[model samples]
Target: MNDSFTLGFGGGGFEAALRNWEPIISQTISFVPTLEGGLKGGMNQREIDRGVDGFKQLIESYFSNVALSENRFTRAVRFK
Candidate 1:
């Protein structure tokens, strides 16, 4: 849950895109630990990082449509 969220634009302007997705990024981060099975599950930082990376890829690559939607914003926010 200590990871940072960063949306990078290759060349075009994407500030709005970044802003639009902030909530999704925050929510994702908040729920990660709970979804990881908690302390008893013996999850380590590396595993958490991997999970974060996977989530990031999932959001950036496939969830663009959901990310763009106004209704499902909270679930999309990842944390930092």
Candidate 2:
């Protein structure tokens, strides 16, 4: 019974890790464009708008991922 519980918990944790990686992966992918936008000048309206959109998206995506990852990791650690 104890072994079964341990295995179940471990499996769940592993599954969660796999599930959680996607947003992080996505944000990582999104990072390059965001950084590029930051590094370059945005003197024009369109360029400035692009930079703002990029920043907003990055922050939204990243913070959401952060919240989810933190919750999951915390729960996992607490479970253990």
Candidate 3:
């Protein structure tokens, strides 16, 4: 479980790094679970923040100079 989370964070961070490599990418990062999970139609404030936090921490912790985004990178149209 821990390994997976670490790998997941690293993978998402890599994506974030790619996204910020050029201006063509959007400022808002398309995050993973926490983001997609929080964005569901009925989620409350805490629920939303929890999801955003997962990806946000990855960017903020390692890429402090980059833009901070509250969004997630989901391949599906509806994450929920």
**Highest-scoring model, TM-score:** 3
In candidate 2, what are the lDDT values of residues 1-80, reduced to their tens digit? 22544432224567676675555566566565654554456466666667778867776776576745666534443332
Ranking by lDDT: 2, 1, 3
37: Cα error in model 1, Å: 8.0
Q: Give the TM-score ranking, best first.
A: 3, 2, 1
Q: Whole-model lDDT for model 2 versus the true structure?
A: 0.57
Candidate 1, overall lDDT?
0.53
Off by over 4 Å in 1: 1-41, 63-80
Candidate 3: clashing pairs of residues: 30-72, 30-73, 31-72, 31-73, 34-51
Estimate every model's Cα lDDT from 0 to 1. Answer: 0.53, 0.57, 0.49
lDDT of 1 by residue, 1-80 (tens): 34444533333246655765666667565545533522344777776667667666765654465545555444334342
CA shift of 19, model 3, Å? 11
- Candidate 2: residue 51 Cα off by (Å): 0.7
Model 3 — TM-score against the truth?
0.36
Q: For model 3, how does the per-residue alpha-carbon lDDT over 37-65 read when each residue is reduced to its tens digit?
A: 77677987887888777876865664455
Clashes by residue pair, model 2: none
Error of 3 at 54 (Å): 1.2
Q: Candidate 1's error at 78, in angstroms?
A: 15
Clashes of each: 13, 0, 5
